[model samples]
Target: MKHYLPQVRFWKIISIILALTGVLFTLIGIFCTEGALAVHWGSDGTPNGFAGKIVLVLIALMGVLSMFSGESFRKERPGWHIPVGPEMGYALSTGLTGCCAGVNVIVVLYYFRPDERIPAVGAIAIIVLYLMFIMIAFYRDRRYNGRDVKTGEESHR
Candidate 1:
């Protein structure tokens, strides 16, 4: 556990930063935009659906919740079990908050400049990056936790 402390702390800090970024983007979108923001885009690269500015508030709330959830991974509690380990939890939580931040930024950009075509590939890239983070965390946890990957039994070491 002590050996993994630094890694856990690093992820926690990242999660905090991403959450704060999300909140900032949400604020910018809410106050800066003049009308209903486009929350969804069609396959033709046009915004076919709209949402009230209040939706930004929900995004901000998700950011706050992600921050708290990531912080929970700071320490291991007795009798509490995280199947994928705390490291993975931290990574996933941070990644999710990061995605929210990214989306917030995109929406804000779209509001400011509706003429530009924002490629959906960016969203796909974010998802891939997030999955990579989880895989890295899972492998790292397995390496340090002294447990067999297949049997789930603790190794003597």
Candidate 2:
């Protein structure tokens, strides 16, 4: 557990940094909007509808929730199973980071005009970044579990 503490702390810090960035972006968007920010886009790559800047607030909220969720899942849990277990910290770390990343990208796209949709390539890039983050978290989890603290031997458990 002690050996894993530093790694867990690092993940938490990453989450916090992303969350704060999202919040800052949201605040800027809020101030830049006149009446309401464009929150919906049409299939033709144009803004078709509008909503309050609360949408940005929601994105910021998701960021903060992700930071807490990632921290909560960084600990050991004996009851969790393999695929969705504590040993697989990928879901929390990768999901939160990906979500925050996506939100940040969206905020950037709309921050100035509030009516622009993200380019298709930007969306694809976010997905690829998410997959990469998942792989990283998976590798970290495996490395963290390489040794069994109780048995003091190579851990297969």
Candidate 3:
């Protein structure tokens, strides 16, 4: 497990960086905008609801909390049902954090550009790409750590 430290650290750093970026963008949007920020969007690429600027602050806090949670990947916890190792945890954390950051950026974009709207397909594509990245990271990490991807067991080699 010691060998997995570097990889874990890398993901943790990436998660933090992305989270911080999201927070910064949110703060900027909150301060620069005059009215409530768009919170919910309809499938037709229109925001049907709005939220106070404080919501952006809460979102920023969630981003920070998520970065902290990603630290759990550094070590194993007792009695955990999922047999995820540290490397896999870190990779998954990065994926989740990346998604949150994407959402934050989109929110900020909505604030800055009220006339524009993000297509639902674009959002779905972003999610799919992040999921693919997470899967690829897990596969590569498992190969590097000498584990069988299908069984999640150590390889004889």
TM-score against native, each model: 0.72, 0.67, 0.73
- Candidate 2 lDDT by residue in tens digits, 121-140: 55677677667766666666
Candidate 1 TM-score to native: 0.72
- Candidate 2 residue 9 C-alpha distance from true site, Å: 1.5
Model 1: residues with Cα > 4 Å off, grouped in runs: 1-7, 70-82, 115-119, 146-157
Q: After superposition, how far is residue 133 of candidate 1 from its true place, in Å?
A: 1.6
Clashing residue pairs in candidate 1 are none
Q: Per-residue lDDT for 156 in model 2?
A: 70
Residues 1-157 of candidate 1 have per-residue lDDT tens digits of 3332224776777766776777887888877788899878888888998898878778877766765565456556787665556777778777877777777767777888784365375577578869887887877688778977767788898
Give me the overall lDDT of model 2. 0.61
Clashing pairs in 3: none
Local lDDT at 144 for model 3:
76
Determine which window of 10 residues in candidate 1 has minimal summed lDDT. Answer: 1-10
Question: TM-score-based ranking, best first?
Answer: 3, 1, 2
Where in model 2 is the C-alpha error above 4 Å? Answer: 1-7, 71-82, 85-87, 90-94, 97-101, 111-119, 147-157
Better of 2 and 3 by TM-score: 3
Q: Rate the local accuracy (lDDT) of all candidates.
A: 0.73, 0.61, 0.69
